[model samples]
Target: MLSFAHINNSIFAKSPPFRTAAKRLFHAALSQRMKIIPISVLEDNYSYILVDDKTKEAAVIDPVEPSKILNVLSQTGAKLTSVFTTHHHWDHSGGNVELVAKKPGLAVYGADARIPEINYVCKDHEEFKLGTLTVTPLHTPCHTKGHVCYFVLDPATNERAVFTGDTLFIAGCGRFFEGDARDMYRNLFHVLMRLPEDTWVFCGHEYTRANIKFALSVDPHNEALLAKAAWCQDKTITVPSTIGQELLYNPFLRVNEQALKLAVSKSDPVEVLNTLREMKNSFR
Candidate 1:
């Protein structure tokens, strides 16, 4: 299991600086064929470049900043063959039209027709391939009716990752903007939680610090959450938190627990989740 302590040590063993440590850890962990580059865009949003080393073919997820993504592609020497649009939100699919203009003939995959320049509409639980990597589009509708989280598997080493655009965050979840609490509950518990425990979670935003703050408010005595909160104090990039780690810390994933149920004076998981979302909306 990749604990926060292990992650901290794996990152900062040789270097004291955050950026240097992160870069070293990122490269060191890329022993598998799949390589992920998390690019910061629009202040807090994250755009990822997932590369298949064997084929040198790459796919960009929610590439809001095309210029930044293009620059990274140049450095990696990987061909950008496709775009995985998570939703129809402007921040997620804003660069679709422009990106297609720059690099035409790219397959733009999305579930919503509202997504600009989207050509391939992915169905629920649709499985495809990007090079040797297996891509599964999981339709998680809560933040939006068409929100889809991309679950990718590296068959060579059995490594897994889920690109949860807005449906799921590090220790929190996105607001139920389009759907209700029940939709979010099913999306979180049924769809996402079914993935392997070690599956790395690459969320759409850099909101770990803030999410941890709120998580601690509801589940204050949780040692895992406390450890994560302390680890996040000095960390700027907190992507790639595993599904097991989230189950240990994230309050959203702990709705069935008695502590979370008592936090909002609710026994039913759905009610607790609903109350928790309301509290989060008003928190700080």
Candidate 2:
């Protein structure tokens, strides 16, 4: 049994030397003119197209099929400069080889070496350019050891969207396939949750409806969650959930709530999370 007391031994327990907020995202990054186009594929998978309308340059995140991505590129009239792989999962990386084959010298950035055609290995806080916009790769390794979330920022408009592969979803998170509760705790709270409050959450799957169902069962009385659940029923896709919005309703993000702790009969945050994960696994 993994205990919450040993949290520091997990992958993200050690704090990196991150720059101060003012220096990290300079004041100029407020006027970015980028558009996030969500491509629906493989039943519930999502591939995001980040396009710089000004430069006509773009990057694809979590591409699973080439034809689908290609159609978007053709429609947007944007040239593909790179592919950002969030993890080693087939659903997120299946189109890497084909995209690389179609567009030569197209960089594939990922923390996982297992990601197919990964030519650009991303390091923590590694920044790259997609048609003049800045993309920072945040290493959040709970879903899979090398899972990363791409933070796309427009320096001019200061607009942002995080391409969260399977690490963090809309109202839920990825299953603990490679790591444990402690690792997930840091990934969700210590790392990703610390991003700017208004950051757009562009996750890898369309699992909001199901996630909300489970979320309601656990955090049943949240008004924001209840409203969001009602809204989800009428939509085919639920994404671009803001960080501020997630903080209000996501059960995974609210493990510290007194209600959640009591419902799971756990005192420690990690233990509560583990209990939540176990319960949610069989929720249906």
Candidate 3:
């Protein structure tokens, strides 16, 4: 098994450092566009601060714990200008009212009317801005009828990240609480997966360890799954997994693969996904 450091180094080693002055300058530009700080809250949930370095303005995603979010904002000196709630779940949107009370005039964006203090109810593919970052809200309605995943891009560097609340996780996916397999398939493959391969995936919960365990059970022979398990063993937080990396190990995204279909004795992609979710629901 590879140590955590070795695993990270190996994954990042594919891209060698830039030696040319122009390339170095490009790297610097990429670094300054956006900074994502993951704030762990309430057992396993994650609330994020998306900071646009150029403007010193930030947006908090699923600010479930207002105090922690406020503390980070104070430390970073980034003015909290907006709130991006992925869904109306209490764990994800619980802090909205408190957060708004503390900081007035913060634009609270979401798709559901049930979302606390949701002023800007978003439509599918509604594009908005925060400082230099362009945020596109994609309607992903599996986890909930109004579930949404925020896809944020910094045009300056073209850097991307998605805040997938309960829809998609590192190696596993959320339970089919409100919708069925078809809805989840669309959320995972059709919507979120369609983003650029390098887009960073910041999900709602830090359930990587448990999710990887379940993933390994179904994909025991998968090299990528095994490597991911090893990589996360020593880490406490695992919020940001890239789309490209998820395609390799996430079984939910691999429903079309022959091996995964065989694992559940199904060939049709949707049926395979359905069976996989059922199996996951019961997996210890």
TM-score to native of every candidate shown: 0.91, 0.88, 0.89
RMSD of each: 4.1, 11.2, 6.0
lDDT of each: 0.85, 0.80, 0.82
For model 2, the stretches where C-alpha displacement exceeds 4 angstroms are 1-32
- Candidate whose lDDT is highest: 1
Worst-scoring 10-residue span by lDDT in model 2: 1-10
Pitting candidate 1 against candidate 2, the one with the higher lDDT is 1
lDDT of 1 by residue, 5-89 (tens): 1121334222212224442434445445777777778988989888887898999999999998897778667899999999999
After the best TM-score superposition of candidate 2, give how far the Cα of residue 103 lies from its true spot, in angstroms. 1.4
Error of 3 at 2 (Å): 26
Clashing residue pairs found in predicted model 1: none
lDDT of 2: 0.80
Candidate 1 clash figure, as a count: 0
Candidate 1, superposed: residue stretches over 4 Å from native: 1-31
Q: Report the C-alpha lDDT of model 3 over 1-284, residue by residue, as the tens digit.
A: 00011111112111211111121211222435577777778998988888787898999999998997797678656899999999999999999999999999999999999999999998899799999889999999978999999999888778888999899999989888889999999888889889999888889998899888888877889998888888778666665788999999999999999989889999999999999889988888
User: Where is model 3 poorest over a 10-residue stretch in terms of lDDT?
Assistant: 1-10
Stretches of candidate 3 exceeding 4 Å from the true structure: 1-31
